[model samples]
Target chain A: MWRPLAEAARELIDLCVMSDVDEDEVRAARADVEAAVARLRKVRRTQTLGQQHLTGGRRRPWGNPVIGLRNPIAPPLQVSTDPSGRAATEFHCGPAYEGPPGLVHGGVVSLLLDQLLGHAVGAAGRPGMTGTLTIVYRQGTPLGDLRAEAWIDREDGIKTWAKARMIGPDGVTAEAEGVFILPRAIRERSPSSPTGHIG
Target chain B: MWRPLAEAARELIDLCVMSDVDEDEVRAARADVEAAVARLRKVRRTQTLGQQHLTGGRRRPWGNPVIGLRNPIAPPLQVSTDPSGRAATEFHCGPAYEGPPGLVHGGVVSLLLDQLLGHAVGAAGRPGMTGTLTIVYRQGTPLGDLRAEAWIDREDGIKTWAKARMIGPDGVTAEAEGVFILPRAIRERSPSSPTGHIG
Candidate 1:
C-alpha cells in the first residue's frame, strides 16, 4: 500500500526537479501529500449485522474491559459513529506493531485507545469529540486476536465519560478511560440515528 | 539513515540465493532483520534529553506545555530528568510526518504525548510502566518547531496521574492525560513524588 505512495512521491520530486521549482514548491508538495491523506479520516459505518454483544447484561462478560479491540478493521484501532452512539471498525497489526521483543508497540496500543474511546463517546447517543483518554497496559501482549468494547459511564451536556480496551490473546492486556466531548456542530440527533441504551 | 539497513537486507537475500547454505539460511536472514529492528528499539531510549513537565498546583495547566528539545542528536525527541517533578523535549517533525494539509499527523501527536507522559512518571522520580494516555487534538498542528511538556497531576502508591501536550507554531494543538503504574523499581520511591508538591 505504501509502495504506490512512494512511487507518486518519487514522481512528484522528479517533476519538481524538472521544473526547477523553489524550496517553497517542495513545501507545497508536502502539503499535497498530507492533504491527500486527510481524506482517509472519514470512516464508513457498516450496517449492523443486527448482531448484539450486550444481552440483558447484569451477568457481565468475560475478561477485562481496559484492553481490547472491537472490530478487526477498526484502524485508528478506535471507533467511529453517526449520532446513534453505535460505533464500528476493523483493524490488524503485523511485525511493525511489535514493541518489546514479543510485545506490541505501546504507542500503537494508545492509538487504539483514542480510536475506541472516541467511539464510546459517540455511542452515548451524542455526536462529539474527544476530550481525554487514559489507558493502562498491565502486561506484555502477544500478537493476534484482539477484542474491543466501549460504553458510556457518565454524560453531562457536552461531556461524555466513556471507557474501552483491547483484550489480546493473553487476556486483558490494556484498558482505557476517557471523556468524549460532543461539539456544538452536531450535538443533537440527526433524526436518522435515534437514541438508545448504548455499550 | 535507512539506506544501510535496506542494503544489508538486500545483500543477505542475495547471499542466500548465491550460496548452497540451504533454504534455512533464508529464514535465518529474515530473523536477522527482526533482530536488527529489536536493536533499534533498544537504542531508541537513549535519544531523549529533559524528561517531562509539571504544574505544581491543583489546577490543570491552562495551556499545553511547551517542551524544549535539549539533545542535539535526539531522534526528533529525547527524555531527561527534571528535579521539579516535570519532563520536557524538543523535536522537529519533518517531511516524513504529515497527516493533514501542512500539519503533523495525528498519530504523531499521540506519540509525543506518550513519550512526554512517560517522563512525567519518571519525574515522580519513580519508574513505572504506562497504563493509559489520552490525547485530544485541540486544533491542527504544523510539522515544525514542536514543543511538549508533561508533569504529575496526582499520585498514590500504585497509581500516578499526569498530563501532556504538543505545542507548535499555531498554538496549543493537543492536550493529553495519563495514568501510569509504578513498576516495583520506581514504586518503592513513592514517598518522594507526592501529589500536592512538585518533586
Candidate 2:
C-alpha cells in the first residue's frame, strides 16, 4: 500500500532538487503536496512502535531512511547475502543525495555502511546495536550506481566486529569498520538470543 | 521556492509513517503526490552543480541532506557557532527518523555529527573534506528535542581533528571524533586557502 506512495515521494524529492521550475509551478506543486499531507493526516497511527515485527516475520524497518521500503529518503537499497555470508547491495543515488558537486553525501555513505554492517551482523545469527563505527573515505562517492559489501571480522564476547566497503566506478571509495554489541538487556536475559534491539 | 515544497514533503513523510490511513486514503494521497512530482518534473535544471554559491554568498547548501533548506530528508538543522568557536544546534526528530522502536536512528546521529563536525572545522577557518569519522553510541538517542555540539580538537598540518556529541534528555547519547583533511588538489593550490570542498 505504501510502496507506491514512497516511490512517488522519492520521485518528488529528486525533481525538487534537480528541476528548474518557476515559482508559479513550484506553488502549484506545493499545493498538491500539501493536499496529500492534509489527507494523510486525517488518521494517525496510535501504535507505531513494534510495527516492524508485525510485517510477517520480516526484519526490515519500513520507515528506515537508508533502506526502508516506505521511506522516500532511502535509496531503498535491496540488500542480499551471498553464500559466503557477506551482505551486498548495488544502488544508485540522484541529485537528491548530493553533498558536494556531483558527489554522494559522505553522511549518506555512512548511513549505507551502517545499515549494511547491521545486516552483516544479523546474518551472523547475532543481532546487536551499533557501539562504535569508524569510516574512512578514500575518495568522493559519486552520485550514481554504486556497490557495497560487508562481512564479519570477528567476535569478542558481547561485541561483533565487522568490515564493509563502498565501491564506485573507480573501485574502492570508502571503507568502514564497526563494533556491534548485544544490548545489555538482551545479553542479561539470554546470551544466545538472536532477537534484540538493533540500530 | 523549494523551501515550502521541502517543508510540505517533510510533513507528508511524518504523516506517512505515523498515520493509520486505509488503502483507499493511501491511494488518494499517492495520486496527489504523483501530481506534484509530475508538475515539478516539467523542467530540469541544466546545471545543478555549483548552484550553492548562487545563494547570495551564503555558505549553506539548499539541497543538503543534513542541513539543506531545500532537502526534506534533513531535519534541516540550523547550526550556529558559539562564542567559544563551537558549533551547535537544537533540533527535533519525529517518527520519520526512528530506528530502534522509540529512539532516533543511529545513522541519523552520525549524519548530524558529520555535518556538525564540518561546520566546526569550517568555523575554525579550515574547510576540508572528511577523512575519517568515528562514532560511539553511549545510549539510544531519543526521538524528540535534542542538542548537538562540535569543536575543533586540534590541527595537524592539512588535517583537522574535531569532536562532537549528541545530547538527549538522559544526557550524552553519542560522541563522535572526526578527521578532516584538505583535499590534495586544494592543498597543492594553497595550504592556507579557506575555500575548498567539504563534506
Candidate 3:
C-alpha cells in the first residue's frame, strides 16, 4: 500500500533538488504542490496519531528513514542476517543524495553506518540507543550501488560496541565504530543472565 | 531566486515524510506533483548545469546542507563570529527531523556538528574535507531550538582538528571532534607560513 507513495515521494524529492526551473515555473509548481498538501491534510485529519517510538521488538521496516520501506529519504535496503549473527545490507545512493558533485553526503554515509551497527546489535539480541559513534572516511563515497556490513565487536555491562563499513564499487569508502546502550528497563528484566561481556 | 525554490522544495519534502494520506489521495497528490516536475524539467532543459564543487574563497551560506539557506534539510542557522575566532550558530529542529520519540535523529546531530566544526575551521583560515569525526551523545536532543558552537583545537601540517557542541534547552546534548584535511592546492599556497598549531 505504501510502496507506491514512497516511490512517488522519492521522485518528487529528486526533482526538487536537481531541477533548475525558473521563478514563474516554480511558482506554478508551488500552487500545484499546495493543492496536493491540502488534500493530504484532509485525509490526515481522519487518522489517529502514530506511536512515536518503536516498541515490543516488532520489526519496523518502515519506521526508520534509513531503512524504512515508506520513507523517501531512504535508499532501498535489502538486509540479510548471517547465521553467525552479522548483519549486512546492500543499497544505493542516487543523485538525490549528492553532496560534493558525484560524492555522497558525509552525513548520509554516517546515517547508513549507524543503522548498520544498530541492526547488528539487534541481530545479536541486544538492541539499544546510540551512545557514541566514530567514523573514518577513507575515500569519497560515490553516488551509486554500495554494500555495508556490521558486527558486534564486544559488550561491556549495558553497552554494546559494534563496527561497520561501507563499500562502494571501488573499495571501502567509510568505516565506523559505535557504542549502543541498552535501556534500564530492558536491563532490569534480563538481570543475572549475564551483565557483561558478549563474545 | 533560489530562495523561493528551496522553500517550496522543503515544504514538499516535509509533506512527503509526515503526511498520512490514503492510496487514492496519494494518487491524486502524485498527479499534482508530476505536473510540477514536468514544468521543472522544462525549465532545467533551458539552463546550464551548476558547478559541481565549491571554488574560490567565496563564502556560500547556501552551500552545505547543514546550514544552507535554500536547503530544507537544514535547520535555520544564524551564525555569528566571535572576536576570538570561534564560530557559533543558533538553530531549531522541527518534526521533520524527528528520530526518536521526541528527540532529534543522532545522525542529524552529527550533521550539525560536522558543519559546525567545518565552519569553525574555515573561519580560522583553514577549510577542507572531513577526514574523521567522533560524536558523543551525552543525552537525547529534544526537537526544538538549539545552539551550536565550534572552534579550532589545533592544526598539524594539512590537517585541522576542531571540536563542537550542541546545546538544547536542558543543557549540553551532544559534543564532537573532527579532523579536516586541507587539499594540496590550498596547502601549497600557504606553505611558507607556519603550518603547525593554532590557539
- Per TM-score, the best of the predicted structures is 2
Q: What is the TM-score of chain A in candidate 1?
A: 0.52
TM-score of candidate 3 against the unseen true structure: 0.85
Q: In terms of docking quality, how is candidate 1 classified?
A: incorrect
True contacts kept of each: 0.09, 0.74, 0.38
What's model 3's interface RMSD, roughly to a tenth of an angstrom?
A: 4.5
Q: How much TM-score does chain B earn in each model?
A: 0.57, 0.90, 0.81
TM per candidate comes to 0.51, 0.93, 0.85
lDDT of 1 by residue, A1-199 (tens): 2222222322322222122234444344334333332322232212111111223322111111111121111122334454534454444443223333334456657655655665556455553445555667777655455666666677787777777666777677777776755655455547355233222
DockQ of each: 0.08, 0.70, 0.39
| Clash number by candidate, in order | 54, 0, 0
Which regions of candidate 3 fall more than 4 Å away from where they truly are? A43-50, A53-63, A190-199, B43-63, B76-78, B82-85, B190-199
Task: Give one digit per residue, the lDDT tens place, for model 3 in A82-181.
Answer: 5344889888776555555467767778877877787787777676778999999999888778999999899898888999999999999999999989
Top-scoring candidate (DockQ): 2
lDDT of 1 by residue, B1-199 (tens): 2322222322222222122233343334334333333333332321111111222224121111112111111123555657655888777664233333245545457756776776677666644556766677787677567888888888887888888888888778898887777665344545675432111
Off by over 4 Å in 1: A1-84, A88-90, A119-125, A151-156, A187-199, B1-76, B80-85, B93-108, B123-125, B132-144, B152-162, B185-199
